[model samples]
Target: MKQFISALMDAHLPAPDGLQDGMAHTAGRRFDVYRNNVVHSLITALKVGFPTVTRLLGPENMNRVAGAFLRAHPPTDPRMMYYGAAFPAFLESHKQLDQMGYLADVARLELAIRQAYHAGDAPAMPSEHLAEIPPEALLQTKVHLAPAVQVIRSDWPVLDIWNDAQTAQSKAQDVLITRPAFDPIPQALPPGGATWILALMQGAKLGDALDAATTEAPQFDMGGPLTLLLLGGALVSLE
Candidate 1:
């Protein structure tokens, strides 16, 4: 099985050497056909998985990259949704893409959005609950982000690039993904917003997260992110 899979991914490798005449009839034409179909499917999966990367690199270039990517990282799960999770790192390490350093972050942004979109549904914390928390206790309380909430920190304008690769400004940007309903929405985070989110994710109390955020960026306001958290159904609970 190992030999078959190895040969299937590499065209240069023969089809599980020492095959019977019936299977290897016509110099393994049958296996060749099978291999081509598998490779094509995998490449197509990759293109669909990383559409942003595909468009930036162009179809031809994407195909070449995807081919190499498939050989380096093959699918472990039969589910297509789980494929290409490591594509961002692959792009970052790719010697040819040294000039396009932002590609990896862009891919990470897209991947996060996709993952959030597919995440299981969870009820949003009621606004009344947030309002009920006493001012003094609110800061000491911890908030629970919903299953569909995802955050990504990047050193490039990843959200902008994802929205419009051609004209996106070359500036560092962070991203916040939230699924208020059926579709996941991706937006740029304000200064220190990502830091606050990360702190919350790490189990920090609201006050701690705020202190951390404000210390990093004096102007980091809690109103905006809190509004998004409520409106976007990001906070599932608080404890």
Candidate 2:
């Protein structure tokens, strides 16, 4: 099985020794066709999984990269959606693509979007629930984020690259992805917003998260992140 798998991925490898075509003949030409089909299908899967990467690298470049990618990190999951989960790290280590620092993060963003889109659904917390809580109690309350909420931190302008936002790369862009409806939306987070969200994800209460966020970024504001979470269906429940 191991030898057959190896030959399936690499065209250069000869078919497993003594492999037969069921007619008692060596499977030479028939094996080649089988190998071609498997390689093509895997590459096509990568293109679908990482559409943004395909566009960034162009189809020709993508084909080359995808071919190499499948060999290095073959699909382990039976589900196609779960394929290429390691592709972002693979891109980061790729010698040819290493210079494009933003490419890996862009792939990361795309992966998070796909994850959020497929995440389990939950009812979003209502504004009135929080409104009923006393102002002081609000800080002590813990927020339960939905499964569809994803926070991404990057040292590159990944959101800009994804959106073709032509803005200057003055600083890194942190992102928040939420599946409010059928699709997931990726939006840029305010400074320290990612930190705050990360804190919440780690089971911190609102006030504790605020402290961590403010220490990291004095300009951190709670309104934008809170509103985004609430409206984006990320605020599953507030305890």
Candidate 3:
């Protein structure tokens, strides 16, 4: 019976022949209505989850894209919040949107923001803790990042695009997201900042992370990035 109901929900079962009783037993109209509701709810959830993506694609285009996405990837989990994890990759393969090269990255940035919102919270260590550590041990110390810290890097100007769409003022361009406090909200980091955050997120020591950022960008300023991380609560502690 459960299997039959599942099949019916997926529109896999055909109506059985039974005259007037057919409509009563199948309830085809009701089932269709229910299916439509489910689809609509999922689509609405995706819109909320990826507002920037929707803005870039426009309402009508986003509706079509959302419908196609639903057909291609049906929801597996009962949770609506996590439904659009594959959306970024889906955008990448969509032939119609192939010319919009930055769309996938923009979706990625939005997803990262959602993830950061749900990540576990952690307390940030005071600046004096780093000063207390011996100079020689700094390179060997394992650094920790707050749960709200999310590091995203893309060739496209995803950070700038997100800011432009979300804010009313002008700002620098880069692809990085950091949520300092529950009320402060997330924002983009400057160039090389994301790389530095990535290194620390990977459990690299302070010296190694700084070195990696320097290697990636010759003029990368370690002090500036460190300050940004500290202020954003990205650096939780050192172990």
Candidate 4:
């Protein structure tokens, strides 16, 4: 049964051996039609999963890419929403798309948006919670980010490209993903923001993360990134 399904999945192969519908032989023509429909459905799902990539590459090119991607990496899980998890990396490695360096980052931003939208709900740390902590202790404290928080570090202007839905002129841009409500929002991160967030995500203390970020970018300001987290409700708990 597994072999039959595998053969069916690959359009190049003919109908699986001994395939019959209750003693009536399965028609090759019908099998081909079914295969085409299945491939089309999967391609459509990829289109829906990566809208930004589709827009950038155009429907025709995106469709072709989707077909190639599907052949290389099919959905392991039944859930369609998670099907294209590897697409961003795939785009980055694709020979044809190597010239369009920003395409992968754009795909990543879109993927992050989707992930944030589906992340599990968690209570956000209230503003008053900070008042309870002493200033010194707060700096040494480790913060718990909400499940919907995502950070993308890119060498291209990811946020600008995503916002404009087309390539834009800018320098390297890091992005922060947050879901204050049902919809996820992607905002460009300030200098050192990416470093700080990556450290925090790895369980670094606030002070430690700040130090690390400052080392990466001397002018990195902790205030801006901290304010973004607080305002976006991304800080779930502080320990």
Model 1, 96-168: lDDT tens digits are 9999999999888888888998999899977899899889899999998988888888888888888875666
Q: Which consecutive 10 residues in model 1 have the weakest lDDT in total?
A: 18-27
Best by TM-score: 2
Off by over 4 Å in 1: 17-24, 165-170
Q: Give the deviation of candidate 3 from the true structure as CA RMSD.
A: 3.7
Clashing pairs in 3: none
Q: Per-residue alpha-carbon lDDT of model 2 for 30-148, expressed as tens digits?
A: 89887888888988988898898899999999999988988888888878887888999999989998778899999999999888888998888777888899997999999999898
lDDT of 4: 0.87
Cα deviation in Å at residue 215, candidate 1? 1.2
Q: Give lDDT for model 2.
A: 0.89
User: Taking the tens digit of each residue's C-alpha lDDT, what string does model 4 give over 96-214?
Assistant: 99778999999888889889989999878798887799987988899999999999999998888777745655589999988887888888888899999989999999899999999
Question: Each prediction's Cα lDDT score?
Answer: 0.87, 0.89, 0.75, 0.87
**TM-score for each model:** 0.92, 0.94, 0.83, 0.92
Best of the two (2, 3) by TM-score: 2
How do these models rank on TM-score, best leading? Answer: 2, 1, 4, 3
Question: How big is the positional error of residue 25 in model 1, measured in Å on the Cα after superposition?
Answer: 3.3
Off by over 4 Å in 2: 18-25, 168-170
- Best model number under lDDT: 2
The alpha-carbon RMSD values of the candidates against the true structure, listed in the order shown, are: 2.0, 1.7, 3.7, 2.1
Q: Kindly indicate the candidate among 1 and 4 with the higher TM-score.
A: 1
What TM-score quantifies how close candidate 1 is to the native fold? 0.92
